[model samples]
Target: MSENMEKTIGEVGRVDWSHFSLADFLELRWRLLHDWQAVLPGGEYFGQARIGDVCYDIQIEWLADDELAVTMSPFFPHDGDSAEPPYDELVSGMPYDTQHGASLISSRRSFLELTYESFIDLAEHSILETVARFPHLQSAASKQTGFWDRHDAILCKIREQDDEDR
Candidate 1:
C-alpha cells in the first residue's frame, strides 16, 4: 500500500494518520520553537537541497528528551517566516521585544511526560505523515541511500561556511 514509505515494506505498510490532534501539534510546535532558540542560531537548523528540478528547504530539530521534528519546506523567494528573532538575538541572551528573558521561554511544558518509545514513535510517525502529505519528497529521495544524507552534507557545508566566516 505504500511505495513512498521510507522503509522497504514490499507495499505492505501505509501511513497512519489516525492519531492527529491539534493539541499535540501545538505542543510539539512550541517545543520546536524553544529548541530553535535554545540550540540553534536564528531559531532553525536550516539546510537546502536540490531535489529533482526543485530546491527544497529542510529543517530538523531535536527537542528535549529525544523528540525530533523534521520539516521540509519548498522555497519560494517571497515566502519566509519572520517570527523568529534575528540570528544574534536568538543566540545571544537578548530578548527581541520583551524586557526580560522569562517571556521568551513560552515553550515550556514541565507537566507533559512521554515514554522513550512514545517519543521515538512520535518522531517516526511525524516523518511518515510528512512524506505521505508530500509525495514529492519520497519521489525525490528514492534514489538516495539515506534521507538524512542531504541534511548531513548541508551541516558540513555550514561548518565550512562558519570557519570561512571567522
Candidate 2:
C-alpha cells in the first residue's frame, strides 16, 4: 500500500523479500556485499551519490536478525574541492553547503518493516526526488538506476559461499 511497496513489486523481477525470512535474508546480505563489492566488510555499509558539487553519503545499518536502516546525508564541497567528509561527519542527518557555511535543507522518511527490494526502490526514489530539486544531480541520475536493478550475483554468491558463520 505504501509508495515503496508499489515500486518494489516485480521491478526488475524481484519480490520484496522480508528481513525475517532466513533464506531470503542471507541471500540479501550476500547480494549487498557482492553488488556493492564490499564482501564481509563489517556491519555497516557506506556509499555515496555524487551530483556535481554535492554528494549524498549513503549508509546502510545492518541490524542483527532483523531490518536494515538506510540514512543519507548531502554534503557540498568548497571551491570545487571534491573531498569526502571526515569519517565522523558522515550521516550527520543534515544537508549542508560548505560554500555557504550553513545547513540549508533537510528531508527524512521512514519505512517500517523494511524489505530488500523496497529499500532499493525507496533509495532510488529518494535520490530521484533530490535530483529533481538539485539541477546538478540530473547528470548523474542516469548512472544511479543500475543500483536498484536485480543482480544475478546474489544467488551465485549464496550458492558458492557458506553463510553458516554469518
Please provide, for model 1 over 1-166, each residue's C-alpha lDDT reduced to its tens digit, 9 standing for 90 to 100.
2445445222213322233344544455555556434544323433333323223343454445444444434321111244644322222232222112111011223213543346435544544444345444344333333323444466568778899999
Instruction: List lDDT for all candidates, in order.
Output: 0.38, 0.39
- For each candidate, what TM-score against the reference? 0.34, 0.32
Per-residue lDDT, model 1, residue 15, is: 25
Itemize residue pairs with steric clashes in candidate 2.
none
Model 2 CA lDDT for position 23: 46
For residue 40, what is the lDDT in candidate 2?
38
The alpha-carbon deviation from the true structure for residue 69 of candidate 1, after best TM-score superposition, in angstroms, is 9.6
Give the Å shift of residue 69 in candidate 2: 5.8
User: What is the RMSD of candidate 2?
Assistant: 12.6
Candidate 2 residue-wise lDDT, 26-125, digit = tens? 4544545455344333434244444343455555444333444444555442222446443332222322343222112222124334554565556545
Q: Which ten residues in a row have the lowest lDDT in candidate 1?
A: 98-107
Model 2 lDDT, residue 6, Cα: 42
User: Which has the greatest TM-score?
Assistant: 1
